[model samples]
Target: MPVVLQAGSFGRIRLIYVLVQYVDETPKFGHTAVDSSSGTPILNSSAAGVSPPTPAFTPSHYSHIYGSTPETLTTIDAPKNYGHAPWPRISPREACLLRYFIEELSRWFDLTDPHNNFATSIPQRARSNPILLDAILAASARHFSTLPSDQKAHIMSHYGLSPLPSHIHDSNSELSITEETVIHYHSRCIAELRVLANEPHAVMDEDLLAAVVVLRFFEELDNPFTSPPTETALHGLHVFLRAQASSALLVPGPRQASFWIGFRQEFNLAFSQQRNTNLPLEITDSYLIFTGAEDHVWTNRLVVLGARVLEFSYGSSPSNDLEFNELVRLRDEWVDKRPRSFAPIYTESPDMDTAFPKIWYTDDSHITAAQTLLLINILLLAYSPSIPRIGPSRRQTLESIDAQIRTIVLEICGMALSNRQSRPAGLTACIAINLCADRFTDPQEQRALMGLVVGTTRDSNYWPTKEAERRLRGIWGWDGDDD
Candidate 1:
């Protein structure tokens, strides 16, 4: 019997797996229909007419395309083998928008822009299922709403931005996203989840997985001050999607694999929310190498460390010398193993136009690198003050913590300079800077950091920047400068 990706089992999606080549543009899907011989046993929706047991979550395991080792993680209700889905009809307007995502939005997201394309299955699933189609349109609308109109034409020019029905202009010619629009599209996208409840296998579909993942991405789009985690605000939705993603060894195609690799970004965000949301999904060792690049590899490690920081902070996990020492070791190892290529590049061009270094960490991987550094700094800062009796003279340790924090805060502020476009991850640095502001008696550097955060908020329209700025203002007791 030919093998099929069985997503219904609440299985671990493998980090290390085979990459499937999606055939050329307009290519026919080459895989044969599911002819399951013996695979994971199906779970009955209820045992003796009562609700089935809540499966134990095994986060240590990974999803695999070949081996079934990670299959033991969890067992959710599953539809019979080779089951067919009820293909619901989503609007053509929405369908066209999904294409916009596939042809254009994908370029920005794992598309790596122009030269690269990931989530190849994103296109394949359009006609096959409404769940993915609605998801694409919903995310497309949200993304379009967030983009600065001036940047939209250039970023989405591949499909000729002029007169495209999706374009909606506002007073300042910026893409206008109304609260009503957000609710409408968000509902459209989220409604699909109801369909997947019965078909646990459907939730694991690659295109469906992509839909839910991007939907979570939209959660961060908010006012920062008042709105808290809109995309992630829904506890049950994020939990269910991740539960299924864990079981997926691979989404339908290799192009989609990159999306899963980068899943750590959203994963950490959900787990680190101030409310202390319980572990939604497990992080496996396989995910540590999402991108073959060293920067991505390093970033992945920092992501894991950040998770530990949150867990420790919330008292969900114990803080001991061993964990503390391991974190310190990881930090040093990351630095010691830094490749020459990734050696920080600081070019003080004689040209007056250049304000910051032409390149920071390395070409192409700057955001990921900067994010890694921010995570490391945040993790270290989280551990610095409360050294759980990890081999230290108390006075000396306090002194060292102060000194190290100063250095980290400076590096984090420097990171703001490289954030010319005001990328979303830049928000992380600003938040870290705000946290360390109280340590400095002089408000000058703290004030400068506040400026960067404020500037990024205006330029990027990335909401988290505003949250960081608001926190700083509160800390400094600043008055009515809501401008």
Candidate 2:
């Protein structure tokens, strides 16, 4: 006879077992039941023709058979082109972006307020702000990984992130690294410095330090792989140093000198090492002074320096052999006409007519040749390696010229700052006047010349005292003012 298990309970015999043990093996057996109380089989129906007792279906049967409920199955179907490239690595651009974001955020915490440095600002805050920093790092790495190796390297170099040390490993577990990774690391350094700078309770001196750090980083950006820095980097460093030295920190003594010397040395090295022959003269001068030891080179350097000093003091170009002479002649002529006041350095000769032609009479007639010479002299004075010679008489003259130049530059700066009416031509004229002051030697004479350039009467908006004071402070030097 066949047997059946009770409903909602696991039985010794299931459908397959029942078929195997009874129907398949013993065809003569009909319906049968297995009693739960006793492990014994009981006939319920006869033979194959009779029906067996119905059994109830319950959760326990399925539970024992299949275990627990099956969880919702999930699988990611990546696109067909998904494996084209390996997972992206961190990049320099992303690093820079991350740094920028963090520094900007830190600004909100009043980092500049000397009383609140980073520690005091958030005493309980965790070290490194890992959460934010990691997010930035991950995002940057992903974005940069999409770019080509060379492009990534270039950007990394720009951010000072390339040529990373062996310790900064990537996923391949390989020690070999790409330039882009180094650049990203550099950006991280910058961002870290920026955070420090932004910390409240930062000392006044820290501001200067921050400026120096930024300048140094920029200098590094010019060339990443090479030890020698580029001209662009040198120029940028000089500009920053000049500005910083002139700021409230007053970096004038040995510190300033040391910075300049280092700058000059690096600049020279770059010039000498450069493969390009068509490098600029200024860059060449920068290199030669450091690498070459010839007396003649020193002489040339002195001359250049002297010329620059004179230009800054007098607002006149002494290097222009022709214009220098013409300027002297013009000054003499003007002195002769108005002996009471100093002669104008520049004047129009009604007798001569050419494109922007004006005879600049100097102590000598040869100084009035070409405008190009004048322009060149001006450029040299503005960006020269030489220093000026000072004597009581010359110093007095320089002071006068500097004052006049300051007055003019301040006016132009003010105009630009105001964002007022269109004053493009006026600003250009002001810059030209400043260049003239940079080249000239006699302060009184330069002022007079500047007056002539500005057409005698001063503008109503021109407040000389306040403007001069502001500019002097901006330049971080009191020497410009005659007072």
Candidate 3:
């Protein structure tokens, strides 16, 4: 008889491993006898009156024990080759299972997808799979390399790629270059083309090339790898060529005229604002400097340019011959008003012949004293019409006045120096005398005239005389006469 083991008889049986078997005979439950004390199997279930120990009713016994015979197991439960289980082969089903596992694991691990794919559409499991990622990249490179050169080039251009010659020669090498590297190389090419476009001798076709390069550059501007080109760089290139042509014109060369024409054309285009304003003097000055035209002649030209600017902006005319003459006249009038003589001291009311003469002043008291002021005044006069007009040919009249006053001052100084009797006169006296002196004159009479200007005094009126003497002393660097 076969014995049956009850479910609760064995304390919860844990399944360590499972082996399935198939039966050739009617599946009779069997048991084997074991040494009771030692718990050793001493007898087989096939022995007389000893049937296989009744199989347990547990799920593990049904799955492992009943299918124990190798041949029977092969028929009932297909045997798996534990030594050579196929791996690294992920079917679509397996992929889905893997992705699901990842999603569940990510939740448990608190990992997140930066692309938010997990929150939106499920990512293709192959995309997230490491083994699939390498396969995809390799396959992409192979497909791209298989394309015809022209087609490849077109595609690359669209994507702003510039594959190196070596990359083209070797498909493996192309794999090394990434989208970012391609963009960087293309940007460098565009920058180089922009520089070439500004070269005066750059081929006409180069413009087309530069345009293409710029187009590529613009396309890639949105790429994180490509920095946007600056407007200043473009404008600077255009301006640089114009300046180069202008510089060539300043040199003695056969291309001078042609260069200048080109320069002006380019300049007008590049600086339309200045051209529209008729090229103001400041702009002209800047142009000259940019063209490296630094010379004294250029300096003078700039001054003339400034004058022209003043005329243009302020509605003043450039100085003419008549205006120049007027400047001279103004300068002379300023010189002629200087005093040449000081009053003399008298002991008594002098006799008529010897009485102190009246002091006369010239129009100008000193030489070169009013020169700078005169120049500034001339500049003002030339520029400012509000200043009173002096004469008939307003110009000639001002000039004549200037000359007359200047002559008077020169004459006074001459006489004062000629008549000097004691000490040399102070600056005011010298200036005054020089203004009054004769143009042809002697130094002695000039000095004598200066001393007379010092004046005579009477002792009886000592206080007033002293006061006057003190004043004169201040002028002449002297102490007043003592009692």
Two-way lDDT contest, 1 vs 3, winner: 1
TM-score per prediction, in order, is 0.62, 0.21, 0.14
Where does model 1 exceed 4 Å of error? 1-124, 146-181, 223-262, 266-283, 286-295, 312-318, 347-359, 364-366, 384-400, 419-422, 464-467, 481-483
TM-score between candidate 1 and the true structure? 0.62
Clashes of 2: 54
- lDDT per residue for candidate 2 within 1-483, as digits (tens), equals 333211110121110001112122221123353322122343322332333343553444345556852232113222232223211221233335454334332222221222322223221111223222333333333334434455545655665665344345453222123344433333333333333433333222323333332333333223231243343324324433443334322433323332333333232233223222121234323422333333222322332332332343334443555555543443333224322212225554222222122333221111211211232243333333232456556666556545544444433332222321222222233334433434444444344434433431133111122332333234333255542
The alpha-carbon lDDT assigned to residue 12 of candidate 1 equals 33
Instruction: Report lDDT (CA) for all predictions.
Output: 0.48, 0.32, 0.30
Best by TM-score: 1
Which ranking of candidates, highest TM-score first?
A: 1, 2, 3
Could you give candidate 3's per-residue lDDT for residues 377-468 as a string of tens digits?
Answer: 32344344443456457767555555544444443333333333211112223323222233213334333443444431110100112333
- Candidate 3 error regions (>4 Å): 1-278, 285-293, 296-300, 303-387, 390-397, 400-483
